[model samples]
Target: MGRKTPKSKEKLDKRKEEKALLAEHTALVNKANSQTNPLSSFPAFTKFSKNGLDVTLDCKRVADMDESLIHSIFNLEKENMKNLYDECSWGWNDKKKMEEMTEEAARYLMAKNEAGELVAFSHFRFDLDYGDPVLYCYELQLKQEVRRKGLGKFMMQVLELIAFTSNLHKVILTVLKHNPAAVEFYKALKYEVDETSPQNSVFEEECHYEILSKLNKKIFKT
Candidate 1:
């Protein structure tokens, strides 16, 4: 019997070229979409002050932020804030993927002292596709040196006012279950969890996060 003939090399090469072209086209489309996407631009200055501590909140507008500023705020050498949050909260440190997190972050708020050192930061976002009028707190980080000075509370108030004035209905955040102090702090701010958030249950690998929410609709009479 005659042996079956093999396919020509030219045909195989042509198929490979076609696949490569399609892949390249897809990548271009995704890049275009990402570039055209409208990211929320925050004001350069958002000031928060109460009692005595003075703080200035702002967004990191420059693509390349100062390393010392980040380190002073987070006590980490990394340039990306998301990686620091992951390491501190979840113990999953992947610096390379930090840019992806920024794309998801709708708004970033940073607090700095009078000496020009970053003290705290907050990452909040509106859902990209859900169209729900809610703001989600992606992460909230305060430098260890300033944690007990009521700065966190002031930051929360700033976020709350921003959410209310922006016509949002609610603001939601999550805290590790084991972090009792954080949980208590939210409670002091009148945040309550519903059926969606439970107590004494593991919500994440390294930590159990309790989803806390605060509604913006006025509930009291003047």
Candidate 2:
């Protein structure tokens, strides 16, 4: 036998109905948004494949990349990642972790060769600090063979297009002090460094980062 008061019984019934209605409403809203807007779904995946180069805006697909090519870029194994971790010291994440991180990142660009071998990759996350949305590039790398071939600029243009199409206000990236070439590249593209270091800036580990931003004229045009 169970003891139940009238007020408690009514409240419980009401709560159950509310929960069911809320779940149904959420499903309907999601379905309608997906149908109405393409971006609301899985965002967008754009690919640029030509002569010897192929560029794509995706991350999950990288896991399916050929093992041989992955090894050529950088060993996708834990042992090698450990060596990289020690050298980087900032703590590099594992493959599973990197995949997860990349998924959360809103935008990514991967450059591959004619053989479908990934040569360069870049990952960016959307930041909303500047009223409108802006993308912040967190990681960018290219294999040796692909360097000095104007591929870097092509990747940057792809990233810029992604940001513009997404209606973002600007694109931002932080370049570490070690990479002089990247710094020069961004400078050539008119990206400026915002050097507002904190009071405790003497630490060697706290290397200076160049914060660069490029506005989206399409979205901001008057």
Q: For candidate 1, write residues 56-144 as lDDT tens digits.
A: 87754223355465445344223434443464645655553355344533455678889887777776665411233556776677876
Considering every candidate listed, which one attains the maximal lDDT? 1
* Residue 55 CA displacement from its true place in model 2, Å: 6.5
Off by over 4 Å in 1: 1-45, 49-52, 60-90, 96-100, 128-131, 198-207, 218-222
* Tens-digit lDDT string for candidate 2 (1-222): 778899989999999997786665444333322232222334443455454556553443234445464444343223323444445545566675445433533344566655666677765555543333565666667776666666777667766765666666577776654557878888888876543322235565565455677877885575
Model 1: lDDT equals 0.60
What TM-score against the true fold does each predicted structure earn? 0.60, 0.56
Q: What TM-score would candidate 2 get against the native?
A: 0.56
> Model 1 — which ten-residue stretch has the worst lDDT?
32-41
Q: Return the clash pairs for model 1, or none.
A: 177-208
Please report, in order, the local distance difference test score of every candidate based on alpha carbons.
Answer: 0.60, 0.56
